[model samples]
Target: MKIFNVFPETIFSIGPVHITDTVITTWLVMIAIITISYFATRKLSVKPSFFQEIIEAVFEAIEVTIKDILPVEPWLVIPVLGTLWILIGFSNLAGLIPGLKTPTADLNTTFAFALISFSMTHVIGIATQGLKGYLMHYKEPTWLLLPFHLIAEVTRTIALAVRLFGNMLSGDMITIILLGIVGLLVPVPFSLLHIIIALIQAYIFGVLTLVFIAGGIRTKS
Candidate 1:
């Protein structure tokens, strides 16, 4: 019944540093991604299996989405999109496992992802356009709009974190509560719905990253 207390107590600490359940879940997610990718790409086959086909389809879909968003250098977006898709997709699905918590269910994990996306957006922007150009993006069209642009950037990143964290956490919490209330039978439908939501969240996260990256790459007029 103590849901929020699910995180394990810190086993060790250095100064003010502390580790918890959220950190462990994040490592597990990363490991899952590494294992999947290693096996998926390890054996090069002339004829692909069902799993390979599905994996290929996912990569292809990501490629298409990136191209649609960036047009010119879709490849640049692949590493970010691919990693996010795998990590978030698996984390969301982790709810199906008993006694396991989805990493995204933790605000810290979700915020970390959002921060990475935000940092990458600006880094890519600065790399593509010089530092002067990146800074000038906020000062564009009219000087009066500068504050709005700055606020928009911060708002979007917060929105991204909250949207992902809120959805996954709520879904998992609802499923858990339903299981406790009505036992097993009634939770089935909700579980299926959770699956769909998991996939949708992954897609939304990827698309938003693409959008932010694309926006960053745009030249100011």
Candidate 2:
């Protein structure tokens, strides 16, 4: 599956821990999100700054999505969904920076994100419906379907990871091939299309996470 080293490489290691370019890029993404959010919200004024306005709009959008998706209290998922949207968007677009590869293009990174979504869905499910209640949810119609339900959850998570990873990796490969074959000018449109795809993928990933979370919370057979 390795093509032109489009996959992430171990840039360095500390003691027994090996660090890949994906790790470095993800670190930068997290730091950037935190720093921007902190500074933007630090000074609360009647008339907010551009960053503040943008931040508020982002939060509002996620909040609305949560409200629309969930029947009960939707406050709990807002932060998680917002973070996912912003982080994936950042990671997918990170390739735009010279010398830095997009972390989302790495299967390891995407799988980690998918695992987080899987974990959170169950955690939130249990939170919404106590431990015993959530566990018993699988036995809705009958105990016979428990295994099927569990398998579905796992398969969907894998699909989510692969979907994002495949798209980002293909986009990067195409961009690199174009650049190698025809310098930079021709790839501009493709790069722009890549950006649009990045945003769309981010939106799809976030919405899918929210939908999965909602499914866990709703408690159906």
Candidate 3:
């Protein structure tokens, strides 16, 4: 087994863009999600099949969770939240396959996800509340807190990236070590635990994104 601590090995390069195994695995995960999604929604009926029912149940659960957090205009961000959840879910699970590492185990992938969430939070905030209002929010309670608030914005973004990366990397490492030490079948419980952890990480990441967006739009009373 190839043991990579953090950085993924580069498989090849397309001109300036170096494609790593993580990138290939990530693309495969994306393809899997897209293909599954396409077929799942291809046929529609008033009465649903087993497959359709499963899909609908998943969607309903996600929608309910988003609504519980955002409450208002939940539908507006469903696409983003749903996509993030699926992508992260698949990326985390990809590590289970031999010769394929989980993308989330790499800092690059987690940082990219965090950066996107950070950008969207500000964009949504500015769009919902004017630029002046968004800026003024930092000065709330006292003008002295503005610097701390500004620092927080940057720190939280970094924290998001580091938190996911650390959790995913550590989980993958533990699983790999256990599998190596113990025979495969003996480590089945750890494998299952890893799967559960992957789902929880994805859920946490998605919920946090929703929270950031909601915070952006919430008006100071």
Total backbone clashes of candidate 3, pairs 3 or more residues apart or in separate chains: 0
lDDT of 3 by residue, 87-144 (tens): 9998988887877888999999998999888887877677667798777676777899
Error of 1 at 178 (Å): 0.9
Residue pairs clashing in model 2 are none
Identify the runs in model 3 with alpha carbons over 4 angstroms from their true place: 1-5
Residue pair clashes in candidate 3: none
Those runs of model 1 whose alpha carbons end farther than 4 Å from true positions after fitting are 1-16
Select the stronger candidate by lDDT from 1 and 2.
2
lDDT of 3 at 55: 91
The number of clashing residue pairs in model 1 is: 0
Instruction: Report the number of backbone clashes for model 2.
Output: 0
Best by TM-score: 3
My TM-score estimates for the predictions, one after another, are: 0.90, 0.91, 0.93
lDDT of each: 0.79, 0.84, 0.83
In candidate 1, where is summed lDDT lowest over 10 consecutive residues? 1-10
**lDDT, candidate 2, 52-125, per-residue tens:** 78878878888888799875578777767678889999999988887778899989999999998898788888
Q: What is the alpha-carbon lDDT of model 2 when measured against the actual structure?
A: 0.84
10 residues in a row with least lDDT, candidate 2 = 1-10
Tens digits of per-residue lDDT for model 1 on 96-139?
76656687888887888899889888887777777887787777
